[model samples]
Target: MKLRIAILGTRGIPNNYGGFEHISEYVSEGLVKKGHSVAVYNSHNHSYTASNWNGVDIVHCYDPEYLLGAAGQFAYDFNCIMDARKRKFDVVLIMGYTSSSIWGMLYPKNSAIITNMDGLEWKRSKYSKPVQRFLKYAEKLAVKYSGSYISDSRVIKTYLKDKYAIDSRYIPYGADLFTDFEREQFDQSALLKEDYFLLMARMEPENNIETILEGFSSSTSHKKFKVLGDTGNRFGKFITHKFKKDDRIQFKGPIFDNAAVRSLQNNSYLYFHGHSVGGTNPSLLEAMASEALIAAHDNPFNKSVLNADAFYFNNAAEVRHLVENVQRHDTEKTMVQNNLQKIQYQFNWEKVINEYEEFILECHKKNIHEKVIPGNR
Candidate 1:
């Protein structure tokens, strides 16, 4: 049966930035290809109208500062949920549960709510105490009220099950969109001459940018480190200045285009992923797709995503040890290449979409059965 679906939260279908937005675009396009009617709510800040973008409907949510930063994201997400509730969509797939919990609770009867609680947002070190408390409350409400919840990592799924007694479906983010660009496209010689290690993240405290830079700079090995992505908060600027004079560290700031990021990922010999919070980082997955030798922080989230394949580090000592040891193994490069090949096949969008289609259909059938049972009604 053809289903009418609307993906709510983040910026809509074109997916100009970030992980959830990318998921929205891919899943919506995938559903449309399967003959399902799909609509996506776009933030009004981007100059797109109510037109079909790649065979799916685009509904705009009005907000002037929608593209600003984290604050803008919260506002845009809230508006998206409000707009989604007004639409007659059969299934509403909300990206983040904390921001949309109120709307999910008030959703009309019989509407199947599938909230993708992307990660443990309430546990992030970036948010203030009050905000974190509010998010925790909101997350609880979202899990308790939704018909179903989706988790991107086993760690997060376990958290949800333990906290709310909700067994969320594990639907991890796929890395199929990442491309292994030709090495000739990037200035590999220049990157190598700079003697820089690469790190890409949102420049938040929880991402542990400071610790990574500190470890890299203090290391006896003389290698520069280039940090990408925006310092979205005041703390980022403070940390940047603290490590500014270290000739071994360079902050490249944020690069907007996806292709450019792919080029960076492809050419880098090593990728440093220090995210201490969140689950299944899109950037890390993309780096893995590019076959970069990963040196990730020791966390359950990273372990689950990498399947314990990448080098894990808990402190500066471990980071230094991995940096020194990585070059000793001549077969490491081949192993990384093989891992990328495996990841490409395992994390393809077609397979992910197929699973989504089946799950949605099953949920719909179950909802129909509930409606038919007289006593249950």
Candidate 2:
């Protein structure tokens, strides 16, 4: 069935933002190519000002987020929902609930509403207790309002089933296989292949950025440690100031160039993934696709994706030990190869798009059937 879909809950695509936007970009384009009509809601302040991207329609909503800080997200989400009410979309896919679930009641009732229940936001260490409580309420509201739900990790799917009795669909994030350049050195800096370490993520408490940095700083290795993300935020500033004394650590800021990012991941001797609260992180998938030797924080979300193919670390000491001890042995090569195979067979973009299309079609058909039968409710 050719479905008309509208995607919301991101800063909007050509992906200058994080995971939600990244997936939205690929999913929208992919759906359009499959004879489906898709529209992505972009923020007015987004860099790309176009009305269309590829064959998908782009609806720009007024976003005061730049001026209002955190409060701006509510306004942006409100605008998107209000605009969606006027569209003819058969499926309205809300990507996350952190800033948008409060308006769940205002969502287009005619469309089959599907919420992508992102990682347990209330568990993030970055949020205060009061904020966490509010996020819990928001999650409940999202479940109450959406016609269907999607969980990116199996852990989250199980949690939703256990906590709310909601059987959410499990759809993990996808990544592209890194084949741009074979042995292409990261030309952004003077760093050589297999000589430096890498960590790319937003600077946040839940991400265990401080823990990773502390471990790297204490390690005896002479390799340069590169941290890539915008370090202008409060936590980022704190991390930069705290690690300034360590000359080996370098803050590279945000790098959006796909080739450069993949090259850096491909060339790094060890790539550290410190995310502890998310469900199937996009960066982790990209690292796996790049064949990067991963050292992830020991957590269910990361473990579900990496399994035994990646080295796990719990504390700063473990990080330091891994940093000092891990070498390019035959096992390491085997692990990297295994991760690449997972990317090709399981987490590739084609599989993700196909799964999404099938899921959306299924939800739409159920909604239509329910409306006709009424007793099917």
Candidate 3:
């Protein structure tokens, strides 16, 4: 059935931001190809100013985030939700509950609201205690207001079922296999294949970027440790100052070139995934798809996706040991191959899009049935 779907949350598509925006970009385009009319809500200042992208409608809402900082997100979300009210969408898929869930009461009453519960926002160390408490309440509000839910990781799905007693659909984020890039395409001529360590993530406390960098600094290996992501933020400044003495530790800032990044990941000696708070991270999946030997943070989210296919670490000391000791042995090859297999068979973008289409259609069907039968809701 043809459905009108409005995707809320995120700064909108073509993915200048993180995982949510990345998924939104692909899923929005994919749904359009499948004949669904899709609209994505974008912030006013988002670089992509076009009214439409890849056959999907782009609704630019007035966003004061650049001027207002974090508080601007709430206002932007309010605008998105309010605009969604007039679209008459069949399914309103909210990507995260961090700011949008508070306005849940105002969500269009006619739409079958489905929220993708992204990570445990309340547990992020970046937020103050009061903000964290509000996030906890926001989670509940999302659960209360949405007719259906999506858990992007199996671990997150379990948490939703155990905590809220709601059986959320387990739909993990996906990545495309990296095969088109040539080794020589790497922008940095100084870096050689498998000669440097790579860590790409936001400079957030919970991501344990400091812990990974600390381990690299302490390690005996002389290979360059390339840290990617915007380092202009407060924590980024502190981390840069603390590690300024180490010549091998290079902060390359944000690299948006997809081919360049994939080449780096594909050629890296080891990719350090330190995301401790999120569900199946897009970067982690990309690293796997690129066949990088992974050393992920010891958390249920990372562990579930990697299993015995990658090395695990918790502290600076462990990271140091791994940095110094881990060699590209046959076993390491097996681990890399295992991760690639996971990407091809399970976490591929095609499969993810198909699953989302099926899930959304099913929910729309149930919603129609509920409306037809009074009190069934």
Candidate 4:
């Protein structure tokens, strides 16, 4: 069935931002290709200047986020919801609750609100105690307001089902198999390819970036360790300062260009995924797609995706053990290849998008099927 979909949240398209933007780019474009109407909201400050991208309409909303700090996200979400209400979309898919839940009441009743409850946001170590408390409340509001929920991980699906007693649609993020990339794009230092290990993540405490770096530093391995993503935040600054003296660690700040990221992933001897909280990280899937030997953070979320086909590490010691004795682990290459096969079978972009489409259609159909019998006449 054809549907008019409005995707809210994120800085929007062609995905220079993060995973949410990446998901929006693929889903909006894919839905358009499937003969459905798709509109994605972009921040006025977004890099892509165009009003449309690959047949998907882009609506620019004024984002004063830089000046106002966190308050600006609320403003952006309210503006998007206001615009969306006017459009009268069949399905309005909200990527993450965050600020959106604050403006949930403004979302049009005509639209079927489907929210992606991103990880356990309040549980992140990044947020202040009060902010975390607010997020916990926001989670409740989001669950109450949305017609349905979309979980990016099975672990999350089970969380929502068990906590709120609602069956959230399970549709994880997808990544393109990096069979081709600009091989020369990587910095000369990180150009060692299979000799160096890679750790690409937002330098946050909850992500265990420091833990991974600590382990890598402690190891006697002669290979260089390549680190990506920006160190602009306070946490980032602290991390950089802590690891600055290490000549073996190359801090390639925020390589947003997809080709460069793919090149780094494809060439890296090992990919270190330290995200301990997030649900089914896109980078992890992309690493699997790139056929990198993965050393993922040991957690229920990561375990659900990587299963027994990964070198799981719970702390600095475990990571160090893995690094120091990687050669002793003869099954590392076999596990890496198995992860690649998992991407082919389970995490294919086409399959992910098709599932998303089906879920969107299902939400729309349920909303339409709601019957109101005449009462108290």
Candidate 5:
């Protein structure tokens, strides 16, 4: 069941960005390995300029997001859709509908459109009421226009079913179980010997970045608290301005090197995941793969993955309590082992790719079959 698939709605491959880019990179390469012809759309400003990556074709499309601000993404999607119209792919996989979902109707005919309805973007606190309304409408359009849907978390799958009655395929992101790190590399990082805590997230209001920082500030521990993200937004500015005097907190700008980030995660005494808006976050999965003692925000999405392997935090008070009383749990060894096993067995890359491959083939066949049958739509 080989497929000709096109993945859209991401910045590009090489995974320098967030979850959508990572999914495009892995899915494209993985499907190609399974004898499918996969093409991933890349923004004109993407770092990778090659025509091909890991045996998957790369299609560069015009993107204006760098200059036009948020509006540029819709323009970029329009260009990609126009280009895809000519190619006539068997299946088109759209990673997210942040902007493109509104134009779902513009998507070319003769292709099965399968969209990954990302976490509830409309519910984020960052968006204004009007913007959130638009996002909700976009979600409806995306679900209505797409032939099928994919959800990266079961919590999300349930949301789609309950909210829109759409039966989306459940497919979470996968992580590599990383055990290879150089002692020299870890030593050179100048980090405390598995004593300090670490957090890696986009400096956004909805991600509860300030809550994490405030919690660390409230703690009496002497160990350093390191945060890895660029404070380039207004929300980030507020957090830094408020926490500037905290001597124990350290803000390291964004680190793109996966190996360096992995080393940091693997050696941390505890990794704090504050993102409450996304399902099965890539950073959380990386933390799990690194087998770090996890402290994630207490949300159904986070709980669905971490389960008992993590110590949950709802507010700064809970985070403070978890931080100050970390030793009493005595579950690091058991928790680490449990998380590692989950990554190896459930979130493994092999299983993820197989699921994606099988779903794409199913969509492809059903699409072809629907063309011959009347009233199937």
Candidate 6:
């Protein structure tokens, strides 16, 4: 049956950046091809105005600068969901339940609400006490009201089950094959000239950027270290300045182009994933797909994503040891490649999108059946 679907959260369709935004674009396109009428709620800051975006409708949301971090995201997403309700969509998919739960709870019952509860946001050290409490409550309400819940990692699904008593469906992020141009497009000339290690991530405290920089700096090896992403905050600026004189460490700010990033990912000898929070990071998955020798933080979510194929480090010493010893193991590189192949095969966008299609169809059918059965007949 043809269904009108609306995707909420992360500024919609042409996805300039952010993982959730990319997922929304991909899934919306896929559903459109499958004959479903799709509409994505766009943020006011986006370049595109409310119009038809590749056969799908775009609904614009006003963006206010007063709110910051998760709070800002919540404000925008809450507005998107409220707008979706007025459209009378057959399915409304909301991403990140932290602030959007209030609107999800109010969405019409006939509109199948699918909430993508992105990996444990409340556990992050960044939020204030009241914000954390609000998120926790919002999470519970999201689970209670959502017709279906989606999680990207098994770890997240388990957390939802244990914490909210909600069984969430798992659909991991997908990967694209890197072409020759894509593999060589980024400005990696400096990196290629020296023996360099690569680290790419947002300069957030939870990502352990400081620890990685400190660990690499303390190492005796003359190898260069390239860190990607912006250093906008005080902590990030402090670290960048502290390591300014250190020729071995280079901090390259965020690169927007996918092909440019793919070049960096493919050329790097090793990829350092220092994220200490969240489940199934897209950067880590992208690196794995590129078959770079992976050195990741030792956490349940990291281990689960890498499937024990990559080396795990818990401290600076361990990171240093890996830098010194990583070159000695040729077999390890092959293993990384094998694991990358496995992940690529299993986590393709086509497969993930198809699974989502099935899930939504199942929910629609169930909803129809429930409505048909009269209690007082």
lDDT for each candidate structure: 0.75, 0.93, 0.93, 0.88, 0.88, 0.78
Predicted candidate 3 versus true structure: per-residue lDDT over 1-377, tens digit per residue = 99999999999888998999999999999999999999999988989999999999999999998889999999999999999998789999999999998998999988899999999999999999999999999999999999999999998899999999999998898998886544456665755989999999999999999999999998899899999999999999999999999999999999998878888898899999999997999999999998899999999999999999999999999999999999999999999999999999999989999999999999999888888897986
Residue range 254-290, candidate 4, lDDT tens digits: 9877777887887787789999886989999998987
Clashing pairs in 4: none
Residue 240 of candidate 5: its Cα lDDT?
A: 79
The better-scoring model by TM-score among 5 and 6 is 5
Q: For all candidates, what are the clash counts?
A: 0, 0, 0, 0, 0, 0
Candidate 3 ranges beyond 4 A from true positions: 181-190
Q: Is candidate 3 or candidate 6 better by lDDT?
A: 3
Q: What tens-digit string does per-residue lDDT give for candidate 2 at 254-275? A: 9998878888888899999999
Q: Give the TM-score of candidate 3.
A: 0.98
TM-scores for all predictions: 0.90, 0.98, 0.98, 0.95, 0.97, 0.92
Candidate 5: misplaced stretches above 4 Å?
181-189, 328-330
Q: CA lDDT of 267 in candidate 1?
A: 58
Candidate 6: misplaced stretches above 4 Å? 66-72, 184-194, 374-377
Q: Give the alpha carbon lDDT tens digit for every residue of 1-377 in model 5.
A: 67789999999998887898887778789889889899999999998999999998999999999999999999999999999999979999998888898888789789989999999999899999999999999989998899989999999999999999989999999999875554345555466657888999888888888888788899888888888988888877888789989978888878997877888888887889988886789999989998788999989999999899899888998888877888724557899889999999999889999999989989888888898885799
Q: For model 5, what is the error of residue 114's alpha carbon versus the real structure, in angstroms, after optimal superposition?
A: 0.4
Whose TM-score is higher: candidate 1's or candidate 5's?
Answer: 5
- Report the C-alpha lDDT of model 6 over 1-377, residue by residue, as the tens digit: 88888888676668766788878888898889999999888888788775887888888887663457545776787677667767868787887776678765567667777888897777777777887788788877888788788889889989888877878899888776665666566566634732578998877777877777777788887778888888887767988988888798988888777776766766676779998777677788778777677889999888887776888888888888887777726678776777678666877788988988988887777666766884511
- What is the lDDT for 204 in model 1? 78
- lDDT score, candidate 2, position 126: 88
Candidate 3 collision pairs: none
